[model samples]
Target: MVSLAAALASLAVGKASAEDWAGADAETGQIADIAGLVRLAARFPDSGSVALRLLNAQLAAGEMTAALQKIVVLYSRGYRLSAASEERLLDMADADQAAWLGSLFGRERQSIEASTVFATIPANALLVESLAQDPQSGALYATSVVSHDLFVSVGGGEWRALGLRDAAALTGIVRDPRNGMIWVSSGDPGLGSEPLPGFRGLIGYNPAKGAIVRRIAAPEGSNPSDLAIAPDGTLYVSDGLAGVIYRAAPGAESLEVAVPVGTFRSPQGLAVVRGGKRLYVCDYRYGLAWVDVPSGKVNRLSGPGLQYLDGIDGLWLHGDALIAVQNGNRPMRIVRLVLSSDGKSIESARVLEQANPAWTEPLGGTLVGDQLLYIGNGQWNRFGEGGAPDPDNPPGPTQIRALPLGK
Candidate 1:
C-alpha cells in the first residue's frame, strides 16, 4: 500500500490535472481531444516528473518554439517552476533546446528592453503583487517592480518601460486621468551608495515621453505598499507599517480617510470597484476585506481558499469575482480565485499562473481585463540567495511580462 503522501506526490509528478487540461484547450473552452491533452501535458506536466512526456513530444516534433511556449503557458495557467526542475531542464536540453531555455535568464548589464508573450491571456494578473487600472479609458497600468518599470498597452503600443528618475521599482501603479500622469509608489534609489530606505513615495511618469514627471512623499511620513485613486481623484493608500489606509484628495497631502483599517498587519494591496463605491483591501494578515468608501463600513470577505493563505499579498475585482494573489513559500504562485455566486465568499480557485524559484520571484498580481500582470521581486527570494542588492548587484532581471488572457 503506497503511503498517502507518496500517492499524492506521484499524482503531482505524473499527469496534468483536469483544471490544467481544461485551460490548455481554450478554443472549445473545454478539454476533449488528445491534442489538447498533449498540450496540457507539455505545459503543466503533472507534479512529480516535470512533464517529461510533453518535453519528449516537443523534442520529437521539432517544436522547440512550441515547447518553450508550453512551459511559459503552463506557468501562466498557475504552474510554479522549481529550481530543481530548471536544473533538470538545462541538463537534458540539447544544444538548440538549451539555448532556448537559457535565453530566459536575465543579465546584470543588459536589460530586457521588451518581451511579449502570445500565450493565453488570463483575466487575472498572475504574479502581479499590485495592479492599477483606469476605470474610464479602460486602459490598464501595471508595474513590474522586479523589472523596475511601469507599462500601459490598452490602445496598443509595445509594453513601454516608463523609466523612473531615481532608480524606481514601483509596487502600486495608477493613472491620473485628470492630470494625464501615471504614478507609482516608488522605492529607494538604485544608483547611489546606500540609497534612502524609501524615497518619495508617489513617483509619476509621463506616458507620452516615458520620463519621470515628479516624486512626492507621503506628507505625514506614510510608507505605502499599494495605492488606489478614487473617482474624484482622492488616492487611497495602504500603509504597510501602520496597518492603516489613508486618503489624499488631489493636491492635499494630509491623509483624509484615516479610518482605522482592522488588522492591516502585513496588508498591502487595494482596488476600488464600482467607481469608488467601495475599496477592497488585502489585509493579508487577516484576509481580503473592504471599506465602504461612503459609510466607512468594513467587512471580512475571507472564506475557505483564496484570501486565507499566509502570503495573501494582493487583491483585485474582476467583474463579479474578486481575484486574489498568494505568494506562499518556495514555488511562489499566482491564482485567479472566484467568489461564491452570492458575491460574499471565495468558492473555487483556479491557478491562473505561478512563479517558481528560478524564472522569477512570485510576489503578487493585478487583475486586468482578461489580463493578469504579475510582479516579482528577487530582493526577497526565499529559495536561492535572496536579499537587497549590494553596491552593484546588477539588477536581477527587473523586467515584467504580460501573459495572454486565456480565451
Candidate 2:
C-alpha cells in the first residue's frame, strides 16, 4: 500500500492518465498498476473522475471486493455515478451488495440555502470568469473568457461594456485599494471570437477615466489566469497554463516570477495571509499549499479531517478563514476553510453553498465587507472551441450571488 506521505511527495509529478496501468512499483517492488491508481485516488479524494477510474481498474482486475469498497468510498464522498455505471455495478454484485449500493443514489444532491442573486449579465457577455468591486463607488466589474471584454454595473443595474477590448479572453479582476485601479488578467485558452496573434498579460484600468492606464505582458506562452492583491498593494498573478506565479511590486513595469514553474500543476486561485508574508495557492490537481512570499519556499497544507482541497477555482481570505469556489469538484460546492492559529493547517471546513441550483459552474468572486459576491452561472459549456456558441447548449444570462459571511 502507498503511504499518504509518499503520495503527496509525488504529487508534483502530476496526475496519472486513464491509459496508465501496467507498471512496476519502484518503492515496494509490487505491481504498480493498481497501486498507482490507488495513490491518485487518495490524493484526489474529492475528484469523481479519479474515483471512477479506480473503480473501473478494480473491476478489470477481478477484484470484486476492492471494487465494492471503492463504491462505498464514493458514496461517503457523495459521488454520483451515472445510471449506466450503477446498473453495471448492480449486475455484478450479489443480492446483499446490490441492496446496499441501491441506497447510495441521489445522496450527492445537497440543498442550497442562504444565497441570492446579486446581479445578472446578459448572454452576449459570454463566459465571464471573475468579478471585482470598486471600493469607493460600489460598482461591480466582470471579466469575460469568451467575449474578451470587461463589463461594469452600478447600483444593481445592467452590465455595460467597458472601453478596453484588445486582450484575448479576459479573466481574474481585482481592484487595488490604494489607487482604485482595476486590474485584470488576460490569457488565450483558444476561446476567443477573433484570433489574437500574441497578446496575454495583465491590464490595469483606471475606473474613473474608463481607460487602461498600465499593461504588463506575461511571459511568452504563459496564460495568466488569476490575480490577488496583498494588503501592501503588491499584485500577485497565477499562470494557470504554465504552473507559475508572478509578482509585481506596486507600479512595477514588469512581473517577476514569485514561484517558478514545476512547483504547482495548474495553479488557479490565490489568497494572501499573514500580512502578505504567506500566499495560499490552490493547485487544481494537487490541492492547496502555502508559498513564502519573500523566499518562494512552498509548504503543502494538510491535516487530519480536512476535506479534499482540489478543484478550487476562486479563493478569498475572510478574517481567519478562506472561502473557496470549488467548480472542479464533482458536485461543485463553496466551502469555508478555517485556518489554524499558525496558518499552516486547516482546523475545519464548512460548506457555505453546495449543489447550487443557480450555478452552471462557479468561477471567481470578491469579498465585500462580510459577504462574497461571485459569478454563479459561468456558462462555459455554452461555448465550443474557438469561442463559437454551442447550438445544443443555449446561453443564458449570468447570475452573480451575494452570500453573507457573518463575523
Candidate 3:
C-alpha cells in the first residue's frame, strides 16, 4: 500500500486524475484529511492505502464507530496496521472497543477452528483465483492468475497441471456435470490492458483425456472476470472492466451481451439459477445485482437490515441463500445471504467465516457437496510498487480450504 502523504502529493501536483485514485494511492507518503479520505475510501474500497489513512484520521479525531469500521475494512482488505498505529488507536478506545479491535485484528481466529486443507497448489502456480470440483470423484480444479496452467487434484492427491499456455491470467473455472468437462475463463493479464493475440474467452478442457476440446473467444478486448455455467450449458461471463455480462448459448458462434452495459460497476463473481433464467452478480462499487435472464433487466439488491454487502468477489447459490466471498469490505469474510421470497432483496446475512488467518486475498471457489472449497489466500497484495508481480519476492504455495456449510 502507498503512504497517505505520497498519495495526497499526487493529488496536489495533479499527477493522478480523480478516476485513477486506486493507482495513485499506491505511489507513496502520508497526509491528513479525515472526512475526504474516508469518503474516498468508501467509494474505492479496493484502495487499501486510502482506507489506512482514514483509519489514521479517525483515530486522531476520536471517532470510535468510524475508526472501528475503518479497522474492519482494512482488515478485510488484508491490510495489517502498524504496531504503533494500532497502539495509538487502542489508547483512545474504551475497554469494549479495545477487545473488539483485538478480536477483529488479532490472529486468535486462527485457533477457532481449522478448515480442512483440500489441496495445496504448487508454488509455481501461487496466484490461484478460482476453484471447481467434480462431485462424483471429488476432483478439484483451480485457476491461476499468473500462469496459463490449470491445477487439478483428486481425493486430496498430488496436484497435476493442465497447460493452457496460450492464455494469460486464467480467472474462473466450472465443470459441466452432464459431460464432466471443465470450462475456464482467461483474458488479458489485468483489467486495463488489451488482450494479447489469440486470447480465448471460455475454453473447454476434457479432464478425462487431459486435452483442450474447444475455445470460445469473447468480444474484442473484453476481460472476462468470473463465469457461471447454467444447468442447460449456457455460459455467463462478467467483464470486470467493461461492467457487462456476456452470455453464450451452447455451440453459439460467439458471445453477446446478456445485460446491457453500465449495469454494474466492476462486476466480479456470478451465480446462475438452475433454469438459467436469473443470476446474482457482485458489483465492486455497488452492492449485489439480480439479473433477469429473459428480460435482460438488472436490479440492485438493497433495503434495510443489510450492511457490509459490497466488495464481493465470488458468489455461489446455495439452496435459498447466496454464499459470497466478500474481499472488498471492511472485514474480509464469507457470508450466507438469505434471499427474500421474490429473490430480490436479502432478508439477513450470516457470516460463515471472517478474519481467518488463511485469508491473504480471497477470490473465488467451488462447491463440493456441503462444502464451499475456496482459495484461502490468493496473495494479490504481493505485487510490487510498479503493479507487477515481483519475481524476487515470490508468493509461496496457494492454500485451498473447505468451509463446511453442513448442508
Q: Best by TM-score, which number?
A: 2
Write model 2 residue lDDT over 1-407, tens digit each, in one string. 33323423433422222221111112322323788778865554444555666788889888987787766665554455667888988898787767666666534467667789988889888888889998778799999887778999988787898857577779888898888999998888756555555457889999888898999888777788899989898889998767789988887877889988667767899998848899988877657778877777777675333355777899999998989998877678888888878787777778888887777788888999999999888887888868788999878888889998765
How far off is residue 157 in model 2, in Å?
2.9
TM-score of each: 0.54, 0.86, 0.74
Q: For candidate 3, write residues 176-216 as lDDT tens digits.
A: 88899898887764622444544658888887787888788
Q: Weakest 10 consecutive residues, lDDT, candidate 2?
A: 16-25
| lDDT per residue (tens digit) for residues 333-407 in model 1 | 455556655444456665555543333554444455576665545334321122233434333333334543443
Provide backbone clash counts, one per model.
Answer: 30, 0, 9
lDDT of 3: 0.71
Of the two candidates 1 and 3, the one with more favorable TM-score, higher being better, is 3
Displacement of residue 215 (Cα, Å) in model 3 is: 1.5
